[model samples]
Target: MSLVGSNPTLSATVRWLRVHWGTGSQVKNRTIKWLLGLAWVTAGLYFADKGATYYRQGRTLPPSVINTIPEMPPHRAGDRVLVFAPHPDDEALGCAGVIQQAVQAGAQVWVVYMTSGDGFRLAVERQFRQSHPSPELHIQFGKMRQQEARRAMRLLGLADWRILFLGYPDRGLYPLWSSNWTPSNALRSYYTDTDTNPYRDTLHPGVTYCGQNVLRDVEQVLRRTVPTHVYVTHPADDHPDHAATALFVMSALARLRMQGIGFAQRVVLRHYMVHCGDWPQPQGLHEDEPLTPPPAFFNIGLHWVKLNLTPPQQVRKMNAIKAHTSQMLMMSRFLQSFVRQNELFIEQPVVLPIEASLGVVWEEPDEEDILRNLQAPGDFSAAELRMENGQAVFHINTRSKPRPGFSYSCTVHALLPNGDVTTTLLRTKPGRQSADARVDEDGVTFRLPALPSGSVLVLQAQSRFAGLAVDKTIGHVVRLP
Candidate 1:
């Protein structure tokens, strides 16, 4: 009944083994066979581990790649620079070197923080030594972080007057960008328990926690400062707040362009990334290593740039990072990772008004896939906006058919020539489609209300499952012909 009797190859192998080992030494033969099997298994595991390491290395850009990127133009006298940060320490982490160089070069520098960074529960818990901190305590923590930012900027040679905090919710920026865009349905901060800006020193104290107010604040800042160079977070950052900050800043710039603000066209924009997957390798402090862009962004059409820092500049940058004591307490190593020989940035192209047809394609890099573990319900591959049959048509293409429990939505914010704002949205839920939207096997298409000529539309597409954003596209601005 043994399979060796029915299988010619197996029976021949068994007869050969017996002849080679001799049946009298059967015990020794068995021991040798066991040892051989163990060796093969061990070798297989070792090779697998090595292959995995090589795969990871392929996804991480080496530090020396910074040399290939062009150097950021040095700031000179009369140059006005504005740096926007999603949180207090972000400025120090990403732009401290730039701030120092600009200040030393006699350029005016201003730092605007979108949030107080009070929503971090772990930091508050550590600072207060409490498992459950109250809303008042969170507010107090925010104030403390603001002071830390001031000190950090001072260390980088910036004056107190040049620092501005908008005092918006730390973790609620995306909601403002997507859902709660109107003042009437303002979002409340989970930590501060407030539905409005509470910091008295902010530019617009008591401004509602809504998208419009956030955009308005950014526009006002741009009008007043009129920065020649603007630095903000990258849109593809892993953090939602960081991504939303970019969206809001870009939207404000788009609105300014619609209003015929010439400054918006003249200003230079650069995006810095602080959050990516295990970037700035060999984390912690490696001042000799240059900051390099993550490999996930290598093919994303970004013009990479670098700014090499002198030894003194690097030292000052480190000191400024330490000034963020609240954040250093929790992530000192991660913050210190930015104190490198050079800082990295992407030279953002000027926002131009898109006329007639607009098409945007989002190809997710393999390394940046957020849904690597879970089954991706769906992901955006491309989106287009055009006028069809005298109506505005928005189309989104997905990589695969959307699964049940997944939802997709598209929002368009139009700024009329008269300064009026009109918002339109179309969303499709599992097994249900909005009146304005048509969902098919490949993607979703939405029909928008007719927009007036000269109106600028900011469009965003997002996909979610279980109320969590899984994939999204950066805000695209288009002008009606």
Candidate 2:
């Protein structure tokens, strides 16, 4: 009472509590209980409202976002569309909408899988219930995935004959692209334990698991289909197999172009990204949401296009994705994330030849933060190629200065008119000098044998630290002067 006399507001509060709860130890306990109850109810309502708002926002797509991307060109009756997938389920995840639309438009569509997705150990363990699956078991897993692919394609309105599997190693495409290009150095898959295509129905039965064979098979498919539009994975995809598929496809198209194949000239090339860092946000089935590119790709010089789907088309896509029972057992939510109101693709520009005299420059966006803590030095800032003093010269610039424990390399592919590809590799590491390569403060340069005129040259520059590739440039195709 004496304290309350000094503060009128405290006195009024005390009076109110005493009148309502009765003045005693029981009154204090009652007041505390009531306030605690009120807090619990208020917090429950607040969180419930927040959860509802988040759910709504996650499932809904704004018109502004949809309008920002250009619509994909429609497939017509005469169009021949070819889609290349790195794994079994990727076709359904990335291009089921396109396949359905093409079928509805009477366009001929073909789906080619680079691998049967045999290397996923978790899928193998779940499918066959084996912790240490043998090579034969992996082959069986592959065959099962092949059937799943066929069923999924059937759901997308593709006939069995229209689908082809290359049956290359599932996790070995990058090694083929990087180090194993000849039959002598063919890669052996750790999962399948085979250095050759084991599937009987592959495009080329018993082809060696080498880069040249991959290129040859892709070229064969391109020649046979002569597609007007080609869809493959993006070069910047986080998955090594996905990126290698794009490289093989492009190299084949370039070789075909050099051989006077006109399809390479007019074929429209689009890149679909399946694996990026934490992409396709709100990760489960959200049929009403629009699929968009990852934020890291926003300024990467890519022209993005989207294909809107009907409600029926979305349902069909969901069904196609579900056909991959093995994948569903492992990551159903990740697979279902692609079943949205639309699909996304990077509309690649027509491949153009760079004048050797003027040189060519390739610039890659800085994306070191995308994969945390795996910072390998030498993110490619710019790469230039030109002819100087009877030698082909390569000048590569990196984002940061040359550091210890890092190495830079340039691989040049001379696409001869006679259909032979001669590759030259030049590399330089910290405190090491090579005959053809020179490392500077912020870049590296290489001098190589001059390539003949009328031949095409493709250049790729890479940076490695601790034997791990941290960054690389896209294949830069150039013409000799």
Candidate 3:
């Protein structure tokens, strides 16, 4: 009887051990499988996001009048051409074909690089594989980029002396224009760690990085070069520096004309864009293909000029673009996208005449302007402009209902007939207010005093939604009764 009891106990203990070991092994296997699944999910999400960006970039061009516009004719002999680049490589990227054509026609070509463009953090990182680089390192990178620009222009047949580097801060030009309008209040360079021009061989060494100084240098260049045709960055470009550079050039021209500078009257303005949203589609080398304008700009009322390249001209442009080794090393695809068989430009913005008798005119903001008005990943629609007697109103409409406890605000300004400017700020009510107050459920309206005789109207609109604020500023010239 004792032997039989001992055997039964031993058998039970053995069975318990087997069950425990089997369960532990199975749990271990399941945990490993779960971890593998999670890793795959994370990787899938990452690649999906990258693929979506490239997919958006590959979108096709819509049918539009851009296709019907005539290609730019070849340059006439002795054509004095001036190309203004906000950054080093922009001259090669946007105007390579034109540069080659001008050189072949024996036209005098001058290339002006507004900034060394050393502030592109990603480009710096990619070039040096350094994370958290210091400001001094950025200046070094800027120097390298300047050298690259020189080589690129030389490859395009431009003489060394013809290329001028203004050595302004790469990314600070817009801020300088917006706030630091004087030499005493110059905007400091975030990359160069200095507030004044520091690069060698600049047009004006030691010039402060301010609107006053930038305009002064631009005007000086215009007066000295007396270019018959001038090419600059587009006004609606998404890049702040690019847009500001164009504005500075335009403002300088206006200032010169206002002062009765004779040469300003003869210069023709052409604008090019390099920083638009997914423009110049098929974002790689599409040899023999034509470069077309973005569909969003179809009705913006600007005339586009196209320059078709000869076979050799296209090849030379590609070679010149390739000469931007630092940029090509990182964004080769984007750089090559501009080496197509044609280039494009738009005539400078002309003052849109607002009929005095009509009393009111509604102007819709560009899609880019609407996109910029969003603070987060949200939807926004049109920002409509209305002008009337003694009042200018801005109505910003949103497609998506804003989050709870949200409101809107705007600033209205009048460019008075006598060149004086005035501004008023308006905040929408929380739950609705007076009609004259111009508050509505779908959007907010901001009313300003009537524009002065021969004055212009400007609107700076903002939205407060769930701790996020969206803002955009726009302006237009107005006609007075």
Candidate 4:
């Protein structure tokens, strides 16, 4: 079992068995069978160790984290709350406690579902027991998810009219933000069988499935509701939809601020993490356990807070999450892990106040400390972001130079103040990995649209060698001087 890998004694036994039975001179049928069994055990051990390390490190929060358990804010009589979810069940999983508390305090609350959550193909297939289902069936699945969200929110004491759905394409928000900015080339939702918003219940029913439209819709919601506290997904979430939805929310808030109507520094921006890789360790029903943020985030420049729940509140939260029957059927145990004694949230400022510059600026010693220990020397060395010739230039320095016939890609996203983003996607081998797909490999330089003041740049570089991703890095950089 993979659990054996987490224990040194068990893992050692498995390793010893592998060495004794595998790579031997005898090639008998029984020998082969023993070798196969040993191989499986070895693999299980490897994965178990990985999972163990992840959870162990997460529980050991960094020393620099002050206010590790800050006072949970008491709800005001007329407090307004908004929760933005990339999917339906996420709201209940991450913010059910907050919602219940706010409603109990007579605070107005609104829950916005960004997508129909129709992209969960595995759950749908499992539910239908079909390898392939019709597009109409997929739409029906989306509708089911919507109903599940309604039931979940209702359990949290939210009125049906207070829940809003944007009806965007599930799992395709990042692409819509990256390439499909115009109505003509809007990202089509294969599941819903509509290119633009088709749900009559959506905030903007006819809005096109694009980044700008999503931003506008979010802005409209903010302006209409004027919530005092806005809760959205973390930007570093592993899910593309979760990350992009956060970006969209920030963009909308930025535009509203620019127009002198946005919440700006007045409203509280609380972030909840629903999707991260192997987080909230010991995933199962542990209602008495306390939930903590992953260790990687302690020094990541966000102030985290925990909402301690009463026994009754925890039970209510658990019941609300279970209301999402569509998702619960697929991953009930994983869902129950969130119904712990407390919920974690972070307060992050959305503004990046960088001064406008007319000339090039550079920051040296660009190696990211986080990656230094995680990656090899030749994987990724340094990164630089500079403004030159009216454009934002990004250089990702990699020590492991790309070889001929290999594939390399540089993905860059620039977050601007006006809620608009410019992305540059470059690849050495396009379409095919033939020899002709080679290119100059001195380093990867991406040219993005000129970044205005108050912007931040995020860069990711990866390389594929011999059909394997041998090197990759999420680069870091200092702001323009």
Candidate 5:
């Protein structure tokens, strides 16, 4: 059988010729064979071209990306746990062990699927479009998927209700995000158990659209779940859906933090690799024994909670993956069919110093806004902000305590309204601990030139005293005068 897509022209002609060439078979058989050979060659080009286009257009992952395996950082079991699975099977592949371990340790666990992955529906539809690939046909497939999920959860020994499906079209997600595809087509009007319907106005008006509900649902899930921790798929995973899902979780976490509705006891965050590069070790990784200790992004730490896979739990995990049948036929080699004894994750802590984030709050707010906005008076030192133009404008005037043999420089990363960047380096002679750089009415004269105007600036101070690594890349962003 042809590996994929459409009937081969040679096969068609070969049958035709064999029947007609019975008597004259020897005379013209060689010619027919040669002609059919050309047809196969041309057909091969067509498939190759199609693959090239799909990848170049970013509809598919590149070979390198398709073969990547992800790593999770290390962390304690009692800490909050989060899992971002790109597709249904991904959770099983990347973080199942984490889930098992977290549950055992009484750590909260949450898994988010970025997309519903129904693209293969179309391919399946093509098999017998006239007879079997009907609206009901595709919907049945969905039911099959849900059933598979239930079966898998049982095997994994996971509490059934813990799983959630955002119901995005499986393969079409990348095209929707990076190309011209639309989420509504799949989320709102997919061939579900019922007829096509708008996502917001679904047959079951209560059944929310996957795209619209993902963010809001996740927000609610967070509040209700009250998870002390959050987990998501890797951000750099080659699969666009996986990356997008991780970014969305991060965004939700940011919003929740802003509302001050959640408790913070160092909610550690790290990525679980899945999808392209999420699995199938990258060239360097495979070549280098245990993979270049996963790039720091995936290298949270090696320590992980190991789950004792019971017979039922193992079956459930395997079944959960096998539930995604459409994908299995296409990539059975890569597809999961059995549960391994262990699941892995990274727990790399993205530690932003308090000052780095609160630099804005640390500012001396305009005495006017604070005085007017504040009904009660407290020491306003924490709320002051002084707005000005150029490098010299906002800098606090330096009370000089010249340091020996040291030099000071500041590179201001200013974000312009037009979305372009304007950088200006301000320099000064090194000052003692008690003497930080300063500014005044005359524009504080750092050792360098004046900076340009912009809405926000990320100031980097340097004199070769340090850089960031596992050791010391602390306090990168600083508020200027």
Candidate 6:
């Protein structure tokens, strides 16, 4: 009767075994399994918690990172346009909805795939060492990715004629984009062969995707496509490849426009971002948002565009996104859920219809002094002195020389088209130009007072030369707006 009362239930026996023999490999394995399962569930729950928090905070439908709303079909209708896909997934990741909307709205949309995007799978090739270590796997995998991209586009309702693959292998894009082949520790490398690794096929003998060649090739595309409106990658994105592709597109557009192609009648350029973590958090910025625009931003919206994305069009876009199987497997589904909501753009309030103005343009050569809009007096030709909008950016090119026994006042003037100049925006002459503004080979740039909206404002440069002209080059004027 006593033995019958001690019948071992699974839970009771387990508890008894744990209490009696608490530590062993068998027991340890069970404990570890429980802990690991718990850890995984907790991690998943954390993401969900984050999503819930965002939703409650009213930023749920917003971009989890920098991205664009899907382009609607040709609701308003326009001429043919070409969409630039930096990699296999960029087209879907950035603007699948937009492409569907554009197509349905009656625009002839052409898709251009810039690279095969086979380099991202760094994990798969490592398996070769443990299994069959063949260098040929790299090319084989790359080819597979290209096929995946083609299949994805077809799912998005794109025909074969609408696609163009540059096939320019995409692994070392960052190095190529940042270098002019001047040969430095960073840019100089000897690639004899890739026979030892899985990425061997993807490696080339020369720099096929160098920035200059990229710019030239993309420019040719622009002329041939003749797209009235252009879409490219966001310059501020975290990915080097995406940013390089965007830079190429921007350079091409600017060159064409400078050559008299015009930014409006011929084309309009907009950017889209795919990298999630590094996306700008604009909400944290109350006013005068910090710009992530790398190198510089190109604006094309001095005009008007109005198109509404219908529900069906939005569904088509969502479906197109689902077609990217490999990518869909990798990215978060929550991000995909927000694809149809809103297509945001810079109002391009900077570039307006009445851009011509009687504004002052000033330029200075050295870094010692800052200037106002009036071209007070300086060296350099008006043509040689470059200006963007109405401001001149100063490049402290020479090794900066120190000036002693002189009191220099740093001032920033807000040039209003109404000719009202306000010097109140100057924070501190703290004599720390290095800490205050960002300067490089491109030029020095710092925030200026907002030029009152709808007016041509000018940025000026001036410096007080304290009784010496040889130690420092004096009397310089450079205007950048």
Query: For candidate 2, which ten residues in a row score worst on lDDT?
Result: 1-10
Sort by TM-score, top down from the best: 1, 2, 3, 4, 6, 5
Residue 180, candidate 2: C-alpha displacement in angstroms: 1.7
Listed per candidate, the RMSD to the true structure in angstroms reads 14.8, 17.0, 14.7, 9.5, 18.7, 18.4
Which of 2 and 6 is the better model by lDDT? Answer: 2
Kindly list the per-residue Cα lDDT of model 4 for residues 370-432, writing each as its tens digit: 333323323444555556655566565555454454566666556555656566666664234
lDDT of 1 by residue, 65-157 (tens): 776888878999999999999999899888998999999999999999999888887788889998778889888988999999999999998
TM-score of 5: 0.48
Model 4 misses residue 193 by how many Å? 4.3
Who is ahead in TM-score, 3 or 5? 3
Q: Which stretches of candidate 3 lie over 4 Å from their true place?
A: 1-59, 62-66, 126-129, 358-387, 390-481
lDDT of each: 0.80, 0.81, 0.69, 0.68, 0.43, 0.44
**C-alpha-based local distance difference test score of model 2:** 0.81
Predicted structure 6: lDDT: 0.44
Can you rank all candidates by lDDT, best first? 2, 1, 3, 4, 6, 5
The TM-score values for the models, in the order shown, are 0.83, 0.82, 0.74, 0.73, 0.48, 0.51
Q: Looking at candidate 5, what is the lDDT of residue 388?
A: 30
lDDT (10s digit) by residue, model 5, range 237-273: 5455665566445545544553455442345665665
Candidate 1: segments with Cα more than 4 A from true spot = 1-58, 350-352, 355-377
Better of 4 and 5 by TM-score: 4
For candidate 4, the lDDT comes to: 0.68
Q: RMSD in Å for candidate 2, one decimal? A: 17.0
- For model 5, what is the error of residue 296's alpha carbon versus the real structure, in angstroms, after optimal superposition? 11
Looking at model 3, the pairs that clash are 72-306, 390-450, 391-450
Instruction: Identify the leading candidate in terms of lDDT.
Output: 2
